[model samples]
Target: MPVRGGDLHVGVWEPEGGGPAPPTVLAVHGITASHVGWAELARQLPGVRIVAPDLRGRGRSRDLPAPYGMPTHADDVAAVLDHLGAGPVVVVGHSMGGFVSLVLADRHPDTVSSLVLVDGGMPLLPPPGVAPDEMAGLVLGPAAERLQMTFPSRAAYRDFWREHPALGPGWTDLTTAYVDYDLVGAEPELRPATRVAALGEDIRELVDGDSVQHALDHLRRPATWLVAPRGLMDEVPPLYPDAARDLWTVRYPAVRMVPVEDVNHYTVIMLAEGAAQVRPHVVEALGEAR
Candidate 1:
């Protein structure tokens, strides 16, 4: 789809039996992830249309120029909805996409009817003693580190993720397709498509910038936050810790909190079990949207 800078790559999945206009879900992926990450969610909601986009600096849209931040990403998403003539659709965002979704609804209210925030969309203060600039690296860790590494082959990249503590154990064909789609360039020099600069900008915004905070304060749409108990590496203290989750609950009681047990940050969307947990929320949000 044509946006401000260039063409944005959007992956659209129609339900099994086509209808004139299926209920639509706009899925936004994580910081270093592509639209393909939503494969399981798309499959689970076979009756609804899934329209997912590779945000400007990741996936097939990697070359879309920077100025990368949640607001910019929000506008790009708004442009996508405008191009498709799709609006007031259910928006499901995972990780950084959740931040983007917040700003999208805040800035382009007409385009988003409701939100399904999978392990994201809330404010994350920098851990004590960690500088704002260092928070992304410390939190994102391996997911951000791989962008600087090069792989000899697609298989090599798959091997890298296969050994990942969180993603590896729950690996599936759906996850494999997502991993493959993130690779760009020729053999021996192939690298992840996410731009390091874009990652930095987005992380700063989500963790420190005021846009997300403002969005959270002004959020008017019905939203649901699906919490993952484990962190990015399948460790304790997930991204939205219980204390923070509690704080936000008090602030925005309108946004329902749904706990998804036994899944890490990655599995919440990549694996079947996780998608099963998320499917109902998407359906419910769509119902609310209508």
Candidate 2:
């Protein structure tokens, strides 16, 4: 792990072997999620050199001011690109990270030659008449309060994740070691270095989007969308939309939105099977991008 030095420094992980790797794939995790979320995705992607950045105020790059919205994230990403001495790289982002990716392509098209949006990127028509702050509260309340709960020991953390709704059957098996990798104390609690306020700012960006669809329409790079199947039965929060994914034809014309199965919000990229499914698609995109 390396942290670039600057007002907009971001953390990065580069796998070994340097034979002119494919354009670095910048993996930006969703709200509050550290670069760790892409741990499994990165490991399976040895064919390409990839870097996952801790957005502005999240993870180890917590130096930026508040209101780290789409443009802010885009700028931070561009800065990270310049710092790495890499440009025109392909970007792969999940959930809120996808929104930032869209913004990146919109605002800094020269920095990104291609974009892969996993489980996000389209405009969300939140139920009618929902107030902004209330919607924000609904979307980010859990992370704001820190759902990465502390446990008496590492085993307790592993036990709790096995039953966690957001995780899948194999998440525990894959993440148990990764989550505890940086633990320090005797209790060995799982803790993230990401910040909460940064998460709130990210929610503010999503909920406050001036028509996220309009923003996404400006993407100029090659783009692909991988959507996780989501509906009422699997939805957790009571008020969030449970509608089946609608036709995105009105948004991204060149981008394809494909459904990914057997994976939820977490396991989609955090587990081996899910990554295996996506790895080939990404390789295809890399070939196209090149």
Candidate 3:
């Protein structure tokens, strides 16, 4: 779909044996991920239409140029909703996409009726003296490293993920497809379908920009934040550690936080078990919107 900047790539999924038009949900993927990341979650919502976009500079939209940030991403998503005539839809965002959803609701309230933030949205303040690039490295870790490296073939790419501490054991066909779709370029030089420059700009804005903080401050819609117990590397302490979760719960009392068990940052929405946990919250949010 053509938006203000460029043609955006979107993935739409509807229930099998489709019936009357069901409620739509605008699902957004993480910074490095594409619309395919929402595949598992979409399957869980059997009767709903799930519209997910390859946010500019990621996935098939990788050719979309710079000037990327949360606000620009919000506009792109709004354009998609408008083009589809999807009004007041429930917005679901995972990881950095969660931050974008908050901006979407704030920028175009009429297009969003509620928000579901999965493992993101809350401010992740860097420790003193942490630069933007360093922050990106710290948060993204191997994901950032993979973007700069090349794979010999799709199988090689799969092997790379097969060794990832977080995704190795949790691997499934759906997850495999999601990771395989991320590979681009010719064989022996295949790289992830993510623009390093655009990713850097997005991370800079997300970590340094005050827009997300401001948006959450005045959020009017009902929002639920689902937190994974493990971090990006499948470590013991998750991104939102106990102390951090406690602080956020008290600070942003309106945004209810629910802890999802037995999942890391990546699997929270990309696996069947995690999707089962998230399904009810999405249903409840859609119900509230109705």
- lDDT per prediction? 0.90, 0.67, 0.89
Candidate 2 regions exceeding 4 Å error are 1-16, 147-159, 172-174, 181-192, 211-214, 231-244
Question: How high a TM-score does candidate 3 get?
Answer: 0.96
How would you order the candidates by TM-score, starting with the best? 1, 3, 2
TM-score of 1: 0.97
Q: Write the per-residue lDDT of candidate 2 for residues 95-195, one digit (tens) a residue.
A: 78888988887877788878788776665545658676675555555545544455567767566556656663466444865455423335655554455
RMSD of 2: 3.8
Error of 3 at 131 (Å): 5.6
Q: Write the per-residue lDDT of candidate 1 for residues 129-237, one digit (tens) a residue.
A: 9787888888987777889999999999999999999998878888889889989999999999999999887888877568898898899898999999999999998
TM-score of each: 0.97, 0.81, 0.96
Model 3 has an lDDT value of: 0.89
Worst 10 residues of 2 by lDDT: 231-240
Assess candidate 1 and give its lDDT: 0.90
